[model samples]
Target: MTVTTDIAQRQERRERLVLDHFADETRQDFDAVLATFAHPRYELIPGGEVLDGRDPVHAYYLQTRRAFPDQRHEIIKLRHTEDAVIVEFWLLGTHRGPLNGLPPTGNAFRCRMIALFIFEGETLVCERVYFDSLTMIRQLLAGVSPEALPQVLSGLLEKVPAQTPAVA
Candidate 1:
């Protein structure tokens, strides 16, 4: 086989793997999702969190899914590069469980996200995801009742740092 042909074949395989990974996540089939990863890693950019092994990654998945049981993605675009497949997508979910010390809001959020599916040869190594946390947070608290606003606001403030960075 020619070099160009081999490159094309590799690209096809990566795309297939990425699609299967998304499908498995949407299905909440954790085992299947883990199988797709070479070492099972995730980098949540917004939260500055790195889950870099099977156990930690698995636990992270469980925690997030518990909070948003119906979480799923809608792919907007997929672009392949030499070492990564960058995906633009919408992450949709309903807040049904406690998240970050806050009680369930029962609100649905659809946040646009971008993820870089980094690969090692033909195997996926890490999924580095980027999104605005505030967008999801606002959506989750949008339906809060007037009576609950104070309590909800208080909970949110607890999660925020007391000191704010000065403008450069």
Candidate 2:
């Protein structure tokens, strides 16, 4: 095969791997998702969180899923690079469980995000995700009055579970 053909083949393999990973995640098949990676790793940009290795990555998955049981991604675009596949997607989910001590708002959120699937040859290495945390937070807190803002924030800071959500 010519050099160009070899490069094309590698790109196709990488794309397949990425699509498979996303499918597994959508299916909530964590084990299958883990198997797609050479090493399970994630970099959550907004939170400055780095979860590396199988255990940490697995925990991260569990935590996020608990917070948003119906979480799923809608792919907007995919661009292949020499060392990464950049994906633009919409992450949609309903808040259904506690997140960082804050009770579920029962609100749904749709946030646009970008993730770079870094690779080594055909082996998936890491997924670095970028999104605005505030966008999701704002959507989750849609109908709170300006006068109640302080109380709402204070309650969150105190880790108090509000009986009613400030959902839209």
Candidate 3:
């Protein structure tokens, strides 16, 4: 096979593996989800958190799955370069469990995310992700009574940082 074909195959496989991992997480298949990672060196960015090994990654998935039990991730775009694959997607779910310390609101939420995967051979070694935090927070607080919407809005407006960086 040509070098280009080989790279394409590897990139496709890596994307499949990562998407499968997300599907498994939605189904609460923690073991299947955790097995997709490489090893202790695997790193996931965007959240600014590093998972030392499979165990920590597994824990992270557990918490996330529990919080968004109905979550489904849709891959809207995928592009493969020399040594990495970039995926743009949307995470759709309902807030049925605690998320970022917020109680369940049962409100549906949709958040766009982009992940860049760095590959070593056929395995993914690192992933950098970007998503909208404000949307997540809004959905999490949607369960408040109608009378409390103004209060929530006021709080969020007041909490907005002075120097909010614009997302690219």
Candidate 4:
């Protein structure tokens, strides 16, 4: 195959892998989602959390699913770069279980996110995500005005300094 065609094929595979990972996550298929990673790892930029390896990643998934049983994403865009597939998406879910010492409010949240599906060649090594943490806190808290979000988030953030930021 020509160099151009080979590169295109690689990009296609990476794109497919990213989509498959998202699908698996939405389905809550742990094994399939884990299979997408050649070297599984996640980075939560604003949340300042890092989880590597299958065990930790699985636990993170469980913790999140407990809090938001219907957590899923709606992709807005996907950009394939030389080293990563960047995705812009909206995460939607309802608070069903305890999260960060906060009881379930039965409130729902839809937060926009941008994530980098970092890779080594075609092997996905990490999925690093960035999003507004305050939006989620305010949303889950129910009817909390944006005016008071800073004070509310400041106190809550300290309590949950290491929430696994999800948007893969």
Model 2, position 156, has a per-residue lDDT of 61
* Predicted structure with the largest TM-score when compared to the true one: 1
Candidate lDDT scores, in order, read 0.88, 0.86, 0.71, 0.87
Candidate 3 segments whose C-alpha is farther than 4 A from its true place: 40-47, 143-168
Give per-residue lDDT, candidate 3, residue 116: 73
- Identify the candidate with maximal lDDT: 1
Question: Tell me, what's the RMSD of every candidate?
Answer: 4.0, 7.0, 4.8, 4.2
What value of lDDT does candidate 1 attain over all alpha carbons? 0.88
Candidate 3 clash pair list: none
1 versus 3: better lDDT goes to: 1
Report the lDDT tens digits of candidate 2 across residue range 1-168: 999999989888988988989999989899999998988988877766677899999997898899999999999999999999999999999999877655677889999999999998888889999999899889877875688777667766675333332111
Per-residue lDDT for 114 in model 4? Answer: 96
Q: Which ten residues in a row have the lowest lDDT in candidate 4?
A: 159-168
| TM-scores for every candidate against the unseen true structure | 0.88, 0.87, 0.76, 0.86
Sort order, lDDT high to low = 1, 4, 2, 3
> Please, what are the lDDT tens digits per residue for candidate 3 over residues 54-155?
777777777777778778888898888877788899988887786544556788889898877767887777666778777877777765998977765675
- Find the 10 residues in a row with the least total lDDT in model 3: 159-168
